[model samples]
Target: MMTHWIKSNSTVFGKYLFVKGLSQKVNSKKFEVGKTVFQSLNGRDLLSFEGYTRNEVYSLLWVATELKNVQQSLRLGKRVGLIWSNPIAKASLTHASQNLESSLCCVHENQLFGSSNNYEMLGRSLASTSDIIFLDVPSWSQSNVEEFAAGSNRPVILISSRDLSPAVVYSELLSFYETYGFLRRVILVYLGPGNNPALNTYFTVFPTIGGHLRYVVDGVIESQASWEKGLRLATKFNTEIKQFEKVDEAIDRAHAISTCSHNLSHMHLKLKDVKEMDLDWTFVQSDSHKGLSVSKDLMKAAGHSLIHEVINNQSWIFQACIAAHTSDYRPIIQPPRFEGVD
Candidate 1:
């Protein structure tokens, strides 16, 4: 088979003529905004996970939060860590708190918050734009290759580019792996619109060597809000909704449901607070837990719970919130001594 290489800059960002031959096209410069000058990668190179455990779910949330802050810092040309005490339900993290900090060049909780920020004058050195965005994905050029090649536990080095054939990417990466063994695997994502079936199916053969954490295209078309399609697909896949492999899609729909539930009561609540407030009054009970009662206080808390236990125990955190707010939002409906957050 004959192979032809073409170089063209994306209209989305016309600063640099990038693509598979970016190293040659932008040979003069070290890095361009969206152009890394490394090499193109297949969409299948993106990492994917089942996300069926609390740890996995928690890690995703934590990573996303950190990535958001990192991206923001880069945009601002600053390198300060964001405070992380309030966004999530407090829980002990195994790999998140440290690994994430190192990855983002962030201050750990103790340094950022527990220690005085207002009192002590602490500042992080600004990172170069390219330092935050692009690098040689195979082995960082600025760093020690021997340190990276020491073991098989090397971290993921994502070099996102499009229009590169899988054979070229796989061959190049495979060469690097055999020589330096720097990256454990390749991670890829497409930034443009519409479905790229060819790119999406890039890693089907090398199942053990790639993933899709950033881009999991489900062919949703122009629809912004729709779970019926996902549900229907779930049925066709011969799997219960709870056991669907597309857990990210399930979580997205769950978020939509919870968002709709907020319309019933503009305010959110805690279960304990709801119970204390309604101690004397009577309300409808959930059919699943009759007599035990469902507190609409915050009808849903999804990400906090694990996947298997959620299905087995029949958790209705979100449903309860919807029911409670839908049923009544009047503060006067309280039974007696029910003090809420001021």
Candidate 2:
């Protein structure tokens, strides 16, 4: 299914640009240097998929895939800090960073505010000392982001849920108003949402990438304007736009489904719902199986084809690795150790 998505846009980048790591496997025994060519995203923030070019998105995915099965330590010597509003989010990311040699300073949302100046000062202080900072708090102050960007031009990742409240969405737009090049270095990664920004970016670049591009917006997390924008884009690209009351109905006809519904309780992708889904069709969910939209059994059934937030989890690792390497600190790849055979 992914191959169909790739083949549809194969000629867009022309012949000169060869995508890396599609068919290759990482060598676990020998140490190998990453031969990633310097790109615009190196040492940059990844706030959202809104501003990324198609090539950049594609390259980033490939690099992330390469690093997914990496046997080496992604232990960057840099100081990476995380400021989270949600405890669940904090837990997931903290667990992912166990291998990394980062001094992860967790700043709760309540600790981030005081006076207007104090808020900006806190952001600056955090940015000044950290090599990479993750912002999972709802909304942001422009002054604070400006200060954070000014300190060292360090990469600031803005994480958003699949279903952002109307108020939070407004705050996000306001905070992203950066004229001082802060956005260029900012990477936007989705923690949850059905209308994923990464998928939107991919389809935007390769509009005619084949297959049906249908959107099921339940208004749980998406704003009126945002979903409309998606429809407008779909129409412009000659893609069919359809609606389904149940997600299973959509899955019945779809080659793949990446579900992230904010309804929480009423909506879920269970084993019964996916009975009609083709075995080869891909399945993805943002969160784990406890009280989430996707059930444990469905996740297990999806198997290797099931992607659990690759754009969110693996992209963060890729960005961290790239940031470390660009700053003259290469990630330490652990050499294979043979205990008895050697």
Q: Highest lDDT among the candidates is held by which one?
A: 2
Error of 2 at 7 (Å): 30
| TM-score of model 1 vs. true structure | 0.19
- Write candidate 2's Cα lDDT for 45-136 as tens digits: 65544444433533443333335445656555567677777565566456545656555678876676656545445656887777777666
TM values, all candidates: 0.19, 0.57
Residue-level lDDT of model 1, residues 1-342, one tens digit each, is 111111122111222332222321222221111211111121111121111221222222222223323332212221212212211111111122232232333222344335433311221121221122111121122122222222212121222112112222222222222223221222222222222322322323122222111222333322211122222222222212221223233233121111111112222224564344432211111111221122343345332212122222111211111112122211112121111111
Clashes of 2: 13
Highest TM-score scorer: 2
Candidate 2 C-alpha RMSD relative to the actual structure:
13.0
Each model's C-alpha lDDT?
0.22, 0.43
Model 2 lDDT at residue 273 = 52
